[model samples]
Each structure stands twice: as structure tokens, then as C-alpha cells.
Target chain A: MDYGEADRILTLLTREMGRISARAPGARRSQKRFAGRLDRFALVAVRLSGPPHRLTLLEAELEEPFLGLRDRLESSAAAAYVVEVSAALSPEGEAQPRIFGLVLEALAHLAEADGPPSPDLLRAFELKALDAAGLMPALDACAACGGPLAGEGIGFSPAGGGAVCPDHAAADPAASPLSPADVHHLRALARAPLGEPRADVGRAAHRRQASALRTFLDAQLGRRPRSAAFLEQVMET
Target chain B: MAEADPIRRLIHQLSRLPGVGEKTATRLAFHLLRADRAICLDLARALEEVSAQVGLCGRCANLAAIDPCPTCRDERRTDDTICVVERPQDQWALERAPEYRGRFHVLHGALDPLSGIGPEQLQIASLLHRLAPAAVREVILATNPTVEGEATALYLARLLKPLGVKVTRIAQGVALGSEIEYADQGTLSRALAHRHDFG
Candidate 1:
């Protein structure tokens, strides 16, 4: 949650609240406000007042805007992606305080590292979004058995919201099955904080998590956004 | 409405579906309420059928209605020329390339050890079985040009070589629009190595 080396202003799109405008009011002019200032990916605090529609900023202080992504390209897109989704999913004028914090955490982690960090950040954001939206999957006890979820092999059913225990497996034969480790990996992402969480686990697990999330998203969102496809194409190229 | 209300819960579920926005979900929920009871039941039945019936192919491990899958079941397909690919989609991509009339042996996915998807996990065992028949002349590895795909192809080549069947890798030629003059060294080398035998 540190947005050091920058103190500017931004009109962030909150997933919980609609497009809200806030100004630092000489934030860039002073060192104190500038030190913890707004930058891309860094999360910031803002004071504003408006009706149920318009958001106006009264005062501003940068919390963390994921300043690490200030230069790179890939991480920037990743940051933009989270932002875009946050913007799209957020209601026009409601107090989604939790989503604001969650988004900041997600973007900060993606930009914190120098290189192409494992897509762990993206997955975490996605899962967190689901959680904040009250769509977090049940992964610990069997979705069916209410027993522990241990063992070498497990299965993923995106439609089922998590691993289907031996007892409560998906009724659909076409349920996208996932491995046990994948479920564990997903659980880790879901539980971890957005900043510097355990994302660099393995490629297979990441892919599995990604695909599972994608299916869930498609099912929920009704269609994959162009941004998701753009990310895939970029990775493929 | 209250946060815990069941009516709100239904709206939430509808909004979660693909293409169904909050407005649309609300509209659909109302539509179902007024529509014939049987229509809603039909929709529910379709959902049940797909989830309960469709599963991955046991041999190639691709999604299908049956265990062995349609591709593996077809006896008319040539057992000799097994076209290896990464995913089921890639198999379909090749199917569109009808010139390759031989039967296909999907790897289910390419070997990506970094992700912990080893040769052991993919349908490599089934692929090995396809090679046991003596009539098999060549196995063409058609993975993508990506690092993981190349790694997968190399792994397969090494594994299949021991079987004594002629193991070959498909070459990626420069695009039709490219000229030999502008081709990179790697592409130029590949073009030279895979030059067709002219009469």
C-alpha cells in the first residue's frame, strides 16, 4: 500500500461506486502528499461529496496505486484490466468500500514486481472480485461431503464453484474437472492478499486456475470481455 | 429489498450468468415467471443433460460425449500417421486442413513441465500405444511455435524415437506473404532443411 515517488491525481473507477472524481488539491505541489501520492496501480484515499450519481473529490492522499507499473507495458495492461473490470462492474453510486480496497491491493501487487510476474496477481484479483461480489467458491470442505479436501488428485467444477467432493460431484458430466493441487492453488490465491502473495507457484496450476476462472466468468458475465481475449492474445504472442 | 432476501438472491444468480446483466436478469426472471412452466423446465433439463452426459475423452483426454471419443473410435483412420497436437481445438484446426487424412492422436496438451504438466500426465501413454503397430510410418508433431509447444514436441520426439518408428516434427514455414530475402536466419534455415524433393 505504498505509492512512493509520485503525487498526482487520478479519477479512478471503483467497482463498488461509480466514476468518482477526487483531487489532491496541491497534492503534486507538496512533498508530503506527493510521497504517498496517486500513480497508476497505487491505491489512494479521497474525500468527496455528491448525489447518488456524481462523485466529487474534496481532499486526496495516495495510499498505493501500484507505482511499480509506472514504466512497464505488460503490467500496465494488467493494471488497466483490473481497473477496467472494476469500472465496469461497479454500480453507479453505492458504497462498495471493500471493492475499492480490494482493487487497490490487486493493482499494487501486479505493479510491485519489475518483470512479468506470474499471472497470480490477475487470478487473485479475479477471485477477489468474485468474493467481493459474493461469488467466492467453497474449496475447503468437500462441496458435497463436508469432509476435508486432501489427497493427490482433486477435481474442479467451475459451475459448481469449487472442487466437487466424491459425494457431491457435479451432476453435469461436462463439468470442467480440476486437479486437487489446482483447487489448492486457487484457494491460496483466493485467500492471499493482493500484494506479493504466493503467485509464482507453477504454470500448469496457473493455467488451470485461469481457465477455470475464465469459464466461471463466461458463465457469469454471459460472455468474455474483449479485454480477457486481449490478454490471452498478448500472452500467446 | 433487504440484503438477505431470497428474491434478491435470485436476481444475483441471474446477473451472474453470461450475457445477463442486472437489468436483463431481472427481465428474464420475470419472463420465466409469466412463461409456460414447461419452457423453464426444458431449459433446466438441457442444463442437466450437458453436465451429466459430456466428459473428457479417456484416450486423447479431449471433451466428448463418449469415453474413447469419436476420433479414436473410427477404425478407418490410418493408424500409421498419427498427427500429434496440443489441445482438442488444435485437432479441429488440423481437421480443417483436410490434406492430412491420417488419424490424429491428441496429446490433450503439450508438455509444459514448468506448470507441472509432465509427459506422464498428458495422453502420452495412449500415443505410445498408437505407435506399437508396425504399419505406422511417421509421427508428425504439430505443436505451436511457442516455447512450451516446442518443449512438448522435443519431449515427444525423444520418447517416440526409441520406439523405432520414424519420428518427424512439422516445420513452420515463413508466411506466404514473406519473401526469402526478408526471412530471418531461423526461418531460412528451417526452409532449407525442409525443402521439398523436386523431380
Candidate 2:
């Protein structure tokens, strides 16, 4: 969530960019000049000194941070989880701007009331994260036959990372099935604008996608994020 | 992230704390190792006890040994006043304030339709059961000020209103050390609504 506070510098690492820390001084503490600027959702402007070779510090700005996420614990938790992933996956002094942008986009969706970071917002984030990590699940062709995908969701392995058509699913009765709906839904969330959606039906559909993504990601990660338990304690009834 | 050693192993475990990282974890682990034997023993005993004895309270689902818990069993506290919260921490926070003298109900969690957590996942059934039997008057929802908290409060408010319980929200405000000058619109509004009479 980035919008108002333009001064605090956050060290962000993307799979693309080497470790990059940008400064938006007074982001959390400053107001008025950057009132409601550094929101927890969308992207914002940040100026940072690149490591070693790049001597001059340059000002960097973003489209926005997911702006509307402060009030809901679900959205907040999902967004926090994304940030945590970003922090963990990327190493020091490596900048991956594409992955950074992906995370920023995810944060923006999380900030919206109808954002993808709902209690079940797990799937979308996971899919996007995996994709950014070049860990995209096999959805297009069958993992077995390499044929085109069929149906709403296809049986797949989290270990393999994509859709396993019904025949392959039948062959491997115990294999994890990737929902086609879920895959496309995550793709949509990755591309959609970071604001409250106008329709409940669309939101509901997205929510379902997020839920499926959660299962898929947890399966892929094998280990859930430690924050998942605490965040669940706060959200689940 | 370094060569393995006893010191490093301890640091690794220490880093598991919610917010701790490599540096802080290293510092704390070393601190514990260097401390008095008795201190270490005390911690070991505490850990063992928590694992062995601590469990959810039967009445409130809070962590306690007793079945009904002291709070639930106390006769002096108003049984009619029920303070509802999402966790034991929230209940503790309310108890820390002297202004509230009512009894409490820990939901254990709020309503999060996502993550497959629904109404059945919570202690709502227990809460609903407690209502008709107890001489409860007001139900104060003390969930966090976050959106999920509000959504939960509102949902419960609707549910309990039909039961004839006076459901209320714990107003949001600038916390004790919060600067009034820097407070936002929503917080200010909440603070004003729940203003206490100092006189």
C-alpha cells in the first residue's frame, strides 16, 4: 500500500532487480505534503541509491500502493503476507523490477474492499508469486500428454506447478488438481485495477479464485508462511 | 544463512519469534545462553508447563487450567454485561482498563468467510447459547479496529439484535499516546462518540 507518505525508504528486492532499497522519506511519519500518499495498497514514488556501481541517487515513482486496505484484517493480512514473501524470496543487492511491480500490483488489489487479499485471498497471491518466481503451474498442456487443458479446473500437482487434465488426474488418482477457473482468476487479479470492484458477482467470482489459489500455493510452498497461523487467528471465526 | 554452530542454531530458533530476524535472534539467543542457570531453568520450566498444563478454558475458551475460569465464576462482576472480543489478548486489554466492569466472551476469532472459516468455525454457537441462559443486557464487541473486526461486529450486531441484546461497537480512537493533532476523521469521530466524562 503506497500513496501519501513520500519520505520513508523501504528496501525492496525483486527477482529481476538486484537488492534495491528506495527512500520515500517521512512515508510513515510525514503527512500533508504526502497526505495519504504511502497507502498500503498501490504503488508510490521512491528515490533510492543503487548499490556499488550506480553512484547518483535517483527518484523513483510508482503508479500507486493498494490504497483502500487499512480497515480490513483479511486484506491487511494478505498484503502483509505478500510483503513477507517479497522480503524472504529476494536476496541482498539484487533488483528485479518486474517482480517488484507484481508485488506492488498485488498490494493494490489487497487494499480494495473487493480486493484479492480477502480471508481466502490466498490463491491469487500464491499464483502471482509463483509466476514471478518463474514457478508457474502447468495449465496449458497436460503434464502427461502435453495436450491442451480442458474443463473448469484440471487435476495437477503442486510439485509440478500446473493443470493435469482429467485423464491424467484419473491415472494419478491422488494428484493435486489445479482448478482452471482458479488459474484464470489469478491471471485476472494480476491484471485488474486496484480499487473496489463495482459488482458483487465479480467480487464473488474473484474471491473463489483467491480461495483456490490459497490451496494451490500452500500445496506448492509445502510449508505455509508462519504469519498464516497468526493472521488466521485474527481473521477466522 | 551461515556455517552451522551451537550459537547459530540458537540464533535460528530465536529468529522464529514473530518479528525477530537474524540479528535480534542472535542477540537474544546469546543472552539466554549467557544468563544464570536458574534463569534458563526457569524458562525451561515455563515452556514445559505451557506445553503440559495450559489449555482452553471450558467456559470462555481462554487459556487457563480451571474449567469455568475465575472471570466466568466471579459473582461480583455483572453477568448481564458481556464484552465480546476476538481473542484472549483483547479480553486482557479490556481487563487492563478499569472503566469496564462487565464480564466477557472470547469469540476466539471473528467472521472471516475466506480461508474456509465460517460462522460454524467460531464459538458463536456457544455465545448464542450463553445469551438465553444468562441475564445478559449489553454485548460490547471489542474486536480490533480493522475492517474484518468491523464486519464481524456488524454481523454479530445484526444477529444479536434480534435476540434483544443491546449490541455496541468499541469506538475507534487515538490510543493513549496517540497525538490528537494527527488523528484522522474516523478516529476522531469514534473518540468523540465514546468520550468519557472526566467530571
The iRMS of the candidates, in order, is: 18.4, 10.2
> Lowest-scoring 10 consecutive residues by lDDT in candidate 2 chain B?
B111-120
Could you tell me the fnat of model 2?
Answer: 0.02
DockQ of each: 0.01, 0.06
Docking class of 2: incorrect
Please give, for residues B1-199, the per-residue lDDT of candidate 2 as tens digits.
6648877877776676654657778778878888998997898799888888877777667777676888888887888888889998888878999888888888878754334345567777778888887489899988866545665775577579999889887766677776788664545655786688796
Model 1 CA lDDT for position A173: 59
The parts of candidate 2 lying over 4 Å away from their true place are A1-97, A114-124, A140-146, A150-155, A159-161, A164-170, A174-216, A224-237, B1-76, B85-99, B106-129, B132-134, B143-164, B175-178, B181-199
Error of 2 at A9 (Å): 19
Error of 1 at B165 (Å): 44
Candidate 1 i-RMS: 18.4
Candidate 2 global TM-score = 0.52
Model 1 agreement with the true structure over A76-171: per-residue lDDT tens digits: 456556765665556555556667777766666666666754677777788787777676767787665566666644555566666676545546
lDDT of 2 by residue, A47-157 (tens): 445454342225434344343554455665566567666555555566756557767666656665552345334554565567766676665577667876667546655
